[model samples]
Target: MTTSPNAPMTSPTRRDITAETGLPYVPPGTIPAPASAYDGLPRDTAVAGDRGWDRDSELSQMSKAVIATVFGLALLIAAFAVIGRLGGWAADYGTILVYLAFFLWMSIAGRVFWWGADTLIAEIRKKSNTGDCR
Candidate 1:
């Protein structure tokens, strides 16, 4: 019943599936099952093993921390800039300067910290011949 984008398309009928599988087609709605199958089950067994740090979490602790810090700094700087403008000493150049000084510094610091820490740790692990990343 599946076709590639360039393939000639044909509407799939139950006959098509039955022909492919050589078994009678039982439509999904016809299946009898409880509404909450495996309800209350833990998603996965609680197990720990050598799932390495180099390949585990979607984002490492350092990465999440760095992103959060940069985002927070950006928010704080923008808020302060707006407040400054509202306080009657508004200069476009001043706001820009504040942004450059604070946000730019924070962003650079975050990138540097994440990169430096990760590289340093990786290098250390490489020297020690302990990290199995390939």
Candidate 2:
């Protein structure tokens, strides 16, 4: 909060920062926001900031893959049971089980990919900011 002697300090508080920038102050190390803080904004929660679509797309893809794998396994199991009872399909059981296992493995792989991507992006951001020294 220090300013050069030649520079005039007009605003002194978080309220003043909000008034000047139209951005609210979120306390450090907290995620859940109280209702009173977001009363008049368009959304129920405050925006943390934007990370661009590459990050967003990776996250979305990971979520969709996980959900698809879970539901796909359930559907395959049900289909196998029905086929085994109605029409003899014992020959296909081993293959379907393998596919289900592969999908589950893919879900875990997707998680690891997302984690690595996030870590790389964060490191890049940190390096870029660290370069802007006085």
Candidate 3:
């Protein structure tokens, strides 16, 4: 069988309104037929990053973050203690230096915590919303 090049293309459509998108529904196996390239096999898995849920990538990202945070906090604590001791060695500067160091440490640490919390919340929201309408 051969279709003339000038013949109009047509397919049977469904009656559904698709309440959400409000677009005319296309019957399954009709419009936009699947291609052999994207039949969801090993070939498709090669584009793993696009899928956004690979375990190894996520593990590496999380581990890097955890290690960096631990290292940073360790440095911060050591600096704080060293500065505190130096401040104590000076009689008149002790209270003032302690207060300044405390403020500085808390301010920077608090902002980092806030940003991490916000990112965590956003990631949680994104994870929870993975293609789920509700």
Candidate 4:
């Protein structure tokens, strides 16, 4: 049999391809299935629920955490300044520098803690909502 130049090819469409491959067929403007669909998957990071903090609430909490961190840093700086006025050579410059470094470490640690807690709680909430939490 001869094929016409204008004839549509017999090759399978994308839906057919996915069906044969056991993969999902994603339509345009639709979110694809998350990685958690395969095996014993990790939780999705995008979902937030009423059990913990919602997205906006999480952002607000993070903002507050950052503010508290900065406040703690400012207190350290003030303490160093007061120690400098007390005529301690170690506190005059070196202590301030060291405290600055320590403040950075503390801020980073706090951020990590807050982020981990938020993620954990959010995942728990998501699982609960989806009826996956046991």
Best candidate per TM-score, number?
3
TM-score of each: 0.27, 0.29, 0.34, 0.32
The whole-model C-alpha lDDT of candidate 1 against the native structure comes to 0.61
Candidates ranked by TM-score, best first? 3, 4, 2, 1
The local lDDT score (0 to 100) that residue 102 gets in candidate 4 is 57
Model 3 per-residue lDDT at 58? 56
| Model 3 score (lDDT) | 0.61
Candidate 4, number of clashes: 0
lDDT of 3 by residue, 4-116 (tens): 99999985345434665678776567877558644667642766446545665556433444554565566567666776465555566676766776678767765555555
How does model 3 score by TM-score? Answer: 0.34
RMSD in angstroms between candidate 2 and the native structure over all alpha carbons: 24.2
- RMSD after Cα superposition, model 4: 18.1
Give each prediction's root-mean-square deviation over alpha carbons. Answer: 16.0, 24.2, 20.8, 18.1
* Model 1: per-residue Cα lDDT at residue 6: 97
Task: Give the lDDT of residue 7 in candidate 1.
Answer: 90
For model 2, state the Cα shift of residue 72 in Å.
22
Runs of candidate 3 with Cα error greater than 4 angstroms are 1-92, 131-134
lDDT of 4 by residue, 10-87 (tens): 877898889899987776779865664334534334434325334554565435545655665565566556654444
